[model samples]
Target: MTSAAENILERPETARRTRLQELWLLFKENRLAILGLVIFVLFFSTAVVGVILTSGEDPVFDPALIRLQEKLLPPLARPNLETLAQGEAPRLGVYLFGTDDL
Candidate 1:
C-alpha cells in the first residue's frame, strides 16, 4: 500500500504540469479548439462592448433601477409622434421593447 504522493515519486515517465500549462498544451495541439476558443472570446467581448455602449444614466443597464411600468402596450413598429402625444414617451421616442405608461 502506498500514498498518492509516493505513487507520483515512483513514476518517472510523466511530468507535473499546472492546470493552465496542461490546458495550453492541449489547446496548442488542436487547431479547431483554438479557433473555437477565439470565437467564444470574440463573442463574449462583443456582448460586453454592446452592453457598455448601449448603457446610459437612465438605469436601463442597471438591474437595480428596473421597476414595473404602468402600461403594457405592444412595442411600436416605428417612431410615432402620435404615441408620444398619446402617452409617456420613451427616451428614444420609440419603445424598442415597449415602455412605461408614464
Candidate 2:
C-alpha cells in the first residue's frame, strides 16, 4: 500500500499541466470573455489606484475655497431667489442630475 501511494505521488505532473493548458485554450477561444475580464481588471485597478492616491486628502476641505454664497447652488442652473421673492415663473436649467441646492 505504501509503495502504491509512493507510485501515485511520483506520477508525472502532466495531468495538472494538461488541465491548465485546457483552461488556457478555453480562455483563448472565448474572446469576449477575455476582453470583459481585461476591462474589469483595468477598471478595478484604476479605482484602487485612485482611492490609494486620494486617500490622504480631506473631502470636506475644498481646496478651491468656494464661498458659502456659492454653496448648494445647482449645477448648470441659476439661482431662482428673485423668482421666489416675486412668486413669478422660475427660470431653471436642465440639471442632468439633481444639484446640491445651497
Candidate 3:
C-alpha cells in the first residue's frame, strides 16, 4: 500500500471533542451569537439574583395574613403611617412589574 493510503487508514488516539463543545466553538465565531449569549446571561443572572434577594415568607398564600387596609397597593407605593404601624413596608418586595393586589 502507498504511504498516503496507510495514513488515511490510521486512527488517532486523541480524545474526540463533544458535540456541545463543537457547537460552542462555532457559536463563538459569530458576533451576533456572542451578543445574544451576553443578553441571555444578563437576563438569567438578573432573574437568579432577584429570586435570591426576594426570598421571604409569602403572605399571599395565607388568607389570614392578608390585610384589607393594604390591599390593591400600587407599585413603589410608600407605606402609610398606619400601614407601617401594622408592620408593612412600601413596595412589598420589589414588584418589578408592579402588583395590583397585596
User: Which candidate's TM-score is highest?
Assistant: 3
* Candidate 2 C-alpha lDDT tens digits along 1-102: 999999999988665557888898999999998999999999999888667643655432223332343346554655445433442222333332323533
Global lDDT of each model?
0.63, 0.57, 0.62
Please list the residue runs of candidate 3 whose C-alpha ends up more than 4 Å from where it truly belongs after superposition.
2-16, 58-83, 90-102
Summarize candidate 3's per-residue lDDT along 1-102 as a digit string, tens digits.
698888877957688899999998999899999999899999999888767655657542233344555557666655455554544443344333433553
List, residue by residue over 1-102, the lDDT tens digit for candidate 1: 478889888878767899999889988999999999999999999898768755877533333332344246567634445534443344555556654544
User: Of the pair 1 and 3, which is ahead by TM-score?
Assistant: 3
Candidate 2: C-alpha lDDT: 0.57
Worst 10 residues of 1 by lDDT: 61-70
TM-score (C-alpha) between model 2 and the true structure: 0.39
Using TM-score, rank the candidates from best to worst.
3, 1, 2
Per-candidate clashes, comma-separated? 0, 2, 0
Write down the TM-score of every candidate: 0.41, 0.39, 0.47
Worst 10 residues of 3 by lDDT: 90-99
lDDT computed for candidate 3:
0.62
